[model samples]
Target chain A: MADTTWLTLAPAFLLGLTGLLVLYVDSIGRSTKGPIAVLSLLGSLAVAGVAIALPDALGLGPAGWSFVSFTLLGMFALALFVQPGSQNRRLIAGLSTAGAVGALGVAAAFLFTFDGEPVNPFGDALVVDGMSLLFAVIVASVTAMVTVASYNYIAEHSYQAEYYALVLLAGTGMTLMASANSLVTVFVALELASLPSYALVAFLKENKGSVEAGLKYFLVGALSSAVFAYGVSLVYGATGSLQLTAVQNAITGEFTGMLGMGVVMVVGGIAFKTASVPFHFWAPEAYEGAPAPISAFLSSASKAAGFVIAFRVFTEAFLQVSESAGEFLVLGADWVLVFQILAVVTMTLGNLAAVTQDKVKRMLAYSSVGHAGYVLMSLAALSGGGATATAKIEAGQFVLAGGMMHLFVYGFMNTGAFLFIALAEYWDVGRTFEDFTGLGRQAPVASVAMTVFMFSLAGLPPFGGFLSKYLLFGATVNSGFVWLAAVAIVNSAVSLYYYSKLVKALWFDERPDDKKPLEISSRPVGLYAAVIFAAVVTTAMYGVFGPVSDAAIEAAAALL
Target chain B: MAVDTSYYLILSAAVFCTGLFGILTRRNALLFLMSVELMLNAANINLVAFSQYYGNLTGQVFALFTMALAAAEVAVGIGIILVLYRNFEDVDVAEAATMRW
Candidate 1:
């Protein structure tokens, strides 16, 4: 933890550079996007290198700070933005690079973190721990990839500069949210991430659906924030504490009804952000309405941030209270049952709705919701002995770790799918199922990549998605939640129908009259190659699960 | 003299519920947005009350941040509404179903 200051300075520096990049690009009149992008990407990568070096110098353990992982992921994701292109190329490159670097720095904080242990806080408003660091890495990695993917995706637009800036800002907000130690920090970070997203959702202003989607997202998001703050207030009133860890000491092992209500309201609010069932109403429209790249960011980075924060807040802090402290109390039993029900409904509804969607983005959005349900089921494994039951809660931690892995894998596959859609849509419109017919005949590379993403999402073997899903569901079953795992299995099966339909359309159906050999004219083939590389590595590494699984398990152990 | 905490909570809850009802029942997008603002303000009131009761500066600071965020949200919210209104001539949530159920 000696060099922990670098973790904070790295992101702060990147954020500052972004403003400078914008100013530089503005001064250059209009054509300097390319150089600015390359410079920014290199700068981000350098910061990431600094982060990686920090771990070696300061060592990992508790001192490496989670921000290191975040910074590295940011560096990797920025690789997508620095692609060679003419469509506001410099600005996209610069912002995307800065965003990635920012994410990496944030993740590094956990590796070099010097905070107290789980359920015990040390930071002013941010709690630095393995759970938060794991999430920081997840958010940074996915954000980097999505930002890179978006570079080519939004190349032709005039407002590309603004788009990249907002995306970067959004990413910075998400990282802050992940490391937030207190409810007050959580709210500020949540809004920081969300407000930018509303604008990004409506970035395609000419599209009516985009405008409406943005409005819907904004209103619902504001409402959820309000509801969440209210729940925080009630918890403050009941426990007389705002620090998540402090809630443990304040709850007098009384007021079961009030406790249950507080937990439910808070869960409901976070659920909206994660797009869990019932609150998942806006995901599909927003995805379909927004540009393809933005859709990728939403489903990947944003979703991961939601789950990570939700997991830490619920399982780490509240779970123990519900189980041990609430013994012979109403809150413990009622809240557990409610979470169980939510898991079932969310997964079931998401999969069923996905099966009916014709638009690929919309279908993926629903699938994303289903994924949230699967993640939520991990909460069912919490032991409720508060911090004291750490020994007995290994099963819950395993499930939680598995959920985290799934989020990481899904971020890659989901965003890659959207990238394919964007690449195809840019050349030819209509993202409906019919439009994908004979895609294999036209753009063989994209079609095949799309197939890989689809199969991966369906949880087929030889893919990272399959391994993650197995880990999660297996852990769920191990935690004595076989029924919940069974539901997840069925949901994954239901998901296959829609996902495979895309594959079938790509390979089997007749080529549409408008189907022409699409040109890979935009960012060269190198960018697509990177996307494919990520997909391949994700799939190929599944066979060697010893290290990956170990890493995840070790990460989860830090939380409990 | 200390003010009753429950009274403030109940009032906040009442206003929040009213906003929830408006969002659910009302068709107009403008009214829907107004309802959301009301909900946000309700949360703000709760924060202030808790701040006073607990004597915590953090609550008041957080309330201030929430207000700033709410303003930004409203700005973006209204911008989108204008875009929708220009495109459809009506800002009714029910009418904006080009994407479908």
Candidate 2:
């Protein structure tokens, strides 16, 4: 077999091993999930390292698929953080392994495309390209981190194993979505991610709040999927093709009217995923009701998948509008305006609503939506003056790079915030903003870590969020969306009030007389994983920004 | 003498509109689910109509696949609603507001 073939199979191979181990260990009554988690994490790390080490000498030409499995591979390493304490130990292990395995499977799917013939016109449903690879890594890593965080987070829960498994499956679905090349593939992959999440959201199945959250999520999620599928059918109706490249080729100037409608429908479907304004009704309830670690995964991994798919569709497929003189395919000006409006509304609503929230989890949910708006600025940048001049296109690339880099940064800060909430819950500390009062005095390490996370989220200097915001807004300004950038700046300032409130509650507030140390059965390897992610994200702000920037630039180049 | 594609399109539109209305208005979780199924079937009608008109089997195959998936969805949706009903006596979604904003 070719080296690439093994590379493609690597994810599946690792996942298969983990699944077998999980089953075997469960049968033997050896419920020590730590070893299984360790095994899967190591497998994931090895696969990523091997994929990255594979020489660039073997290039799959333009018609050929690009090979990069590092994203899913890297996710394996990150999932080591979410280990449960002792109760339902078997379940947590299984879930951790599943998350790792899912990452592996996704990597395999991408790798399978590398040497394969171009299935563009013939229903190659997923294109394994640099862009997909980058996104795959980001989502996978986040999945890994969430899983690792969960082990410690869900230590006392009874259904740890099933929870981990669902998380893994969701990761698999997201990976598939990131690489999806056709409309049908996109729908299936998206559902694969979403269905497991429906279960995960209600993991506390006995709790009424959990059940209600799950139902609301299911109803809204189903509606959104229908909307998305309908949009796909419309594109098929107008263009007579489901393959993205073909759709792009078929939607000419005469077809613009129908294509625009189709685009709106498709965007509406995806916006639900990203929790953008108008389609964002489900986010807060779902996030608040879900177990904290799951919330982290949903917010970070799920939202990133939305943006990746949006980038693939809008930049590569829908934006292939006909230029005058019939030479170039420039993005339409209307898309820029649509995206700008979405950014403003999503950000303003997310931040404004968050300001009034008392529950920590719900506030974070709103914050995530606000960040989604910030990410949209890059998409707006991609469409320059309704024209496809080379300069304008290059500027779009820069904006996209900035947007993508921010996603990478935000994942850490966002996940860390949820992890702290989970920890607070574990310690029997309060989960409301008021409950966090004097946390800096009680739990110094957690409080400090949480403060770092808040500052990062608020886009303060010396943190990853700051760099991401600068890059995103700077790119927008450069793309001639100075006013959009200005609005973003204002939104950032508005976001400060809520984030600072959390900070003040944590550090400056007086401690109550009854404050006590959070009790736990045992500390597992999960915190190590979170610390690694937090460290990387924090240091990345001050160090190694260049590599991430270069990677984003390269990925964006693939789009242009 | 041409077969009427527009007539089929109109039927699809009508069915889809009905499903959409049900989804928007129905407070009962079960009814909302059935409405989603109707909308999916309406999509299938459009697909089959187009496949016949274009002389392509792809859309027909897609419709078949979609129908199978719809069956799976129905099974899962019902199972979930059963759980909901068990937990809360009535299946009214409005009353299932323990997790609401």
Candidate 3:
């Protein structure tokens, strides 16, 4: 047990050490770039090797190591291919990628090797289990992809090392959040992840839009966190415990108004992170104004982390309160009903708003909001009536698995789409509908890859998005929420209109006579490789849905 | 008459609302950040009050963590505001609306 405990923490520790080492190397002001990059690459590979060597007793199984290794290997490649910039920029980016890779490797190792049963390490402050592992892998993959894609996006920027370090640090915080078993850990982990992201959004000090994006994002994030902390206090006051399971046990009796209010506030705070409606006002501006790779990181990895933590707290802790009450109600309100309403309104508003946007980045941002709604539908489905506790548990697993699968698929498709936007930026194309005109003729490979991402995002067949959505809708229907599924399907259809608009712009719109065919100034091999890899994984995901779904089901079953 | 947990709760709630109001109404970026800090401190008040009532150290420890987090947030917030000031020559929240739907 002692050995497993230390082994489980080794990956994160190693990654953190790498980050500090890179900063140290930078501070010394010697010829440090080459050494820093080499150190980072080696550190990532070592983390991967450690992840695989961990014992089964450690709870990270083979499946977990595979995912962790895959992410780290990708990061290693990113570090290799990221063209060195003048001076220390390349070293900084390399170190950041390495740190992210190392952190993700640790998360994967801990999550996969985690026993099917939950373990409360750190005196119940942290839980290592299937759900956390699943989300950890998703978050790590997104971080790795974004770091690789950013190699070219931020190549010209001066503060390369800081940028990469912040990215990796944010990723570490996310992984910690996924495993956090107590409210205290949750709050700390959340801030750890968020602080770095706030800096990353405003990385381009000279760019007005970047600065504004950082400020708005930071304000919203701070507000939500404060609200969340208040809720935690209220929960502690009501239940006298910060451990999630202990809280669950404490709240199973007649729910007090205070507990009810606290739960609502907590959910409200999380809503800001997921970019759900009523709190989604910041997402569009933030995504539109930040650098393209940072946008991808926030929209994909950061959002996934929010959803995972929400899933852990809501399902593991709060879901029981509603269940033990012997009704679908909690403190004068049906919690499921609230989620149901939230799901419908969020998707409808997001799609309608997206349809009116001209800027591609802003439109994608709104579409992401719509996707959040679809995932929320799975949460709502968790409350379906069942004849027995076992039946309810089974249904919960299906619904949770559906949500997990959709998020997994989304990490690739959405990141791929944003990386394409980065590619356009590299080609000096503007970030508008008109900017993509004649892209198909000019950059055939990139245009085709972008089209694939668009199609997948629109939930077209033979792509990962369609299958994931199908599972999500099917989960809802099986749980007897047919109307909710209907709403989701309609939202999916509405989403197609805007996604197809981008595709049409790429193919049918005429190129201006004055504009020359866009050319890649510096061949950003890392950017292209990341986009193509995401696109291929998305396209190929159709063939592996069976195994993926089974794995998700196994992970979900472990939760119950 | 001694103060009770409810009094603390009410006080914090009022403070939280005031902070929210300030955030919604304030136009200066610095003021917005201050309002956010106010909101965070209100939560800290709740944490301390709960800790005293419950006789558990968890709430107090959490409050300390919250303070550290708030400090980190403020530092980052100030840095961003400085950058915003540099670019726009002002810190008015209204002027930061460069990208809107």
Candidate 4:
């Protein structure tokens, strides 16, 4: 049993080792980008092979191992195809991809194998469960896609090594956050993910926009984290424990204003991570100014991490508070209602703001915020349990599963949309709507892929996004929050206007007379491959919703 | 007179509010970082106070971890601030607004 536990951590260790090896090779100055990339890719492939052959090593169930191995395979492909000729760019991408794969493998192993009961590894400070694993898959996949897209996007930038390393390190932090079983673990992991990301957002130091974005992101991030830590401290004061289960046990039958304040602050801090309003001020600027690939990483992976941790902590620790005390009942209800209101406001504000943005990236940033609202709707539904305990649990599971499905679908569609933007940047197209004029005529393949992504993002039918959104809203209605679902439907309608604007620009606008056909840029293969894969999956996900939703339900059942 | 845990909690709360106020009002990047540090330290104070009152080591240990994380945050925060200084010729947060809505 002990050996199995140690083996569960092997993937993360291997990833760390690979990162060190990459750094060592870079420092030695004897290897070029090509050799480093090749070595990292091989290393990742070896890890994937080990994960498959020794599934019991991590004790992750078969499903967990499959996801882990798939993530690694994806990372390997990302490294293999990103920036075909550039040694430096490929090396950075390879290292980051390897790290993400390693983390994903660990998460999957632990998540899949977890018996719906929390596995308290390392003195119960970290947990391996369904929710964590689901998030692990989401975050790791996002990192892989972003790295694949970054191959061409950051090809011209210097300090390629730092960029990739930071990206991987940030991913590691996020994976850690997903499994954090204690408030202390959550704080450390959140910082670990966020600190690196702050640097990544400002990676293009030469660009004024990038620098400004980084500073604002850092300041806001630092403030929110500090507030979160204070909340942790307050919770510790109230419960005398940082371990979540222990805190939950301690707080039972007790009610204090201090505890209520702690819960509020903690939720507030998580809101910043999700970029939900009124805490969402930094997202648009950060997404707009950062490199397109990093924006994708932040919006998709980082946001998913936020939601996962929020789900873990709130449901695990705070959800049952309403049952224990009369005085605290209002506090518990407030928490639920807060999510309900946040769902409406976040989606509405995001869609409304997105409609007005001229810059495509900015519009997408607002749209991402709106998606955060939709995902929050699931949490709101979870809180609005039915009469009986069994009924409540069933509703909670459905809501969580629905939310997870949406996140999974969002990962593919959102990343694909951002990659399309990266392709535009590669061709020197501006980021505004006008810059995309007549793209369909110039680049038929890319335009088609972009249209699919946009449609999926807008929650159009026959796409994964539509199915996931349907599940989410359906769960909300089942939980008796019909109004929230209605709000979501209205928000979806508003979102279509902006998403279709991009489509209109792509097909309807006239191409400039002097403009040439949109030729594939120097590193077109990796970008095209990643975009096409995401597009295909967005459409194909409709068929696989059953199994995926089942997995999500099972995972949610474990958490409950 | 022995100082009670509540006293420490109150102190931490006061310090936290001050830090939050500074973050909201201060426009200088360096000062903003300092305000964040103040807030983190306030959390540390609460952790230590609660550790003693609870007769447990977990809160203390978490406090130590918080300290280490705060240091790391400061290190990165300073690096970014230095870069901001170099690029914008000033560390004023207000001057760094290049990509507003």
TM-score to true structure, per model: 0.84, 0.84, 0.88, 0.88
- For every model in order, the TM-score on chain A comes to 0.81, 0.82, 0.86, 0.86
TM-score of 1: 0.84
- Model 2 collision count: 28
Q: Write the per-residue lDDT of candidate 4 for residues B1-100, one digit (tens) a residue.
A: 3999889988998999999899889899999999999999999999999899989998889889888988988888888888888899999998987777
Q: Which residue pairs in candidate 4 collide?
A: A33-A87, A60-A109, A61-A112, A61-A113
Candidate 2 per-residue lDDT, tens place, A1-560, comes to 22343333334234333433343233233354456556764565565455455534347321122223334433543443434333447464655646474764575355334433222321366666656666676777677777777777776676454466567657767766777878777877788788778878877766677777777888887777776766666666667777777777777566565557667878888898888977898899888888878888889889988898988887777665333433335432366678878988899899999999998888999999999999988886676633456666678789989988888788778988887777776666776777788767766766777888888899998888888898898888888888889989998998888999999988897756676543444444675457456646665666656766776787787776
The parts of candidate 3 lying over 4 Å away from their true place are: A9-11, A28-86, A99-115, A252-255, A321-333, A512-517, A520-522
In candidate 1, what are the lDDT values of residues A1-560, reduced to their tens digit?
Answer: 43454344334235434633443354334354556555655665565566555555565532344455445444533443432223446555656665675656665554445243542232556755565666666666666666666666666666665666677777767776767767777777888788889998988778888887887787678778878877776676666667777775566767566666677788878887888866788888888888877888888888888877787676545744233543322232255577788889998999998999888778888888888888887766554323334434667678878888888788778878877777776766467888777668767777777888898988999787899899989888877777888999999999999999989988998766766643444443424753675577566756545554665676677655
lDDT of 1 at A128: 53
- How far residue A131's Cα lies from its native spot in candidate 2, in Å, is 1.3
True A-B contacts kept by model 3: 0.82
**What is the full ranking by TM-score, best candidate first?**
3, 4, 1, 2
- Candidate with top lDDT is 4
Which 10-residue window in model 2 chain B sums to the lowest lDDT? B72-81
Error of 3 at A489 (Å): 0.5
In model 2, how large is the Cα lDDT of residue B22? 97
- Badly placed stretches (over 4 Å) of model 2 are A1-123, A253-257, A321-333, A385-388, A512-532
